[model samples]
Target: MRKLLASVFVVAMMIGCPAAHAVQPDEVMEDAAKEARARDLSRELRCMVCQNQSIDDSDAPLARDLRLLVRERIAGGDSDSQVIDFLVARYGEFVLLKPRFTLHTLLLWLLPPLALIGGGLALWFYSRRRSKAGSATDPSHLTEEEEVRLERLLAAETSDKQA
Candidate 1:
């Protein structure tokens, strides 16, 4: 079973031919500095369409285009901050993987804990009331005469059983 699993993994690894690996002559980075800058910026940028993935790891066409744009901007002498600022301006703060702490975002972050605590309190109160209700004595209180009658009936049943 281990050998079979290993062979399957090796086969899967060898199957897909990645386009990035077969780069054209023109696509090659002419300068080491620009290449480093591109790598640095790509890591910082999140893929807008694929909200979970970094722009560097995403293989979507839009991610590829954004990567190309980052490379072009870096090659044109834009600083890392400038490239990031440009993207933020174009896509709004949603492009960032980490949402900034603001009033609206703060509420979003706090909602779950607030709801959990509120729900727990409500449940506690409800169950406590229910338990109290369950344990309550009968609404109609038995008079002393009724209580004496009940005891007599119980005693009669026991005496009859021993006969």
Candidate 2:
């Protein structure tokens, strides 16, 4: 029984360890240096169909095509930067997993911090307003007429109890 359980565990591990790599054997370049460059480029390129995944990790047909294109560019003697630029020009900045820092992307980077500071300011002002409103209505700060009315009500209750 123990051996059967051990066998099942080993099989499960082996099956789980082979994560789906979209690169087929045929897609790999003959030159080791070019293959390495292609792989690196693949990791930087976004899988357009699977927006969140890199081309290297995506199983989408478009991702496979992108992977092949990277290898083709590498084989054609394009520098890594050149290959990236080529793809960016063809597909726009969205094809890059990490877009270049530019004027257009400045807002993308700044908006989160700006939003956080704005939210904090709003919260601070809201809390201040709430505290001021609470203090203004406090029983200790009631008008003379309100205080006299409360005292009479209390006195009437006490006299009724005594009677």
- Residues 52-149 of candidate 1 have per-residue lDDT tens digits of 77677676677777788888888888888788888889888777666667886898778889999999999999999997887665434667898889
Backbone atom clashes (below 3 Å) for every candidate = 0, 0
Q: After aligning candidate 2 to the native by TM-score, how far in Å is the CA of 48 from where it should be?
A: 2.1
Residue range 71-120, candidate 2, lDDT tens digits: 88888888999999999999999999988889999998889899999999
Per-model CA lDDT versus the true structure = 0.76, 0.90
Give per-model TM-scores: 0.53, 0.68
TM-score of 1: 0.53
Residue 97 Cα positional deviation in candidate 1, in Å, after optimal superposition: 2.0
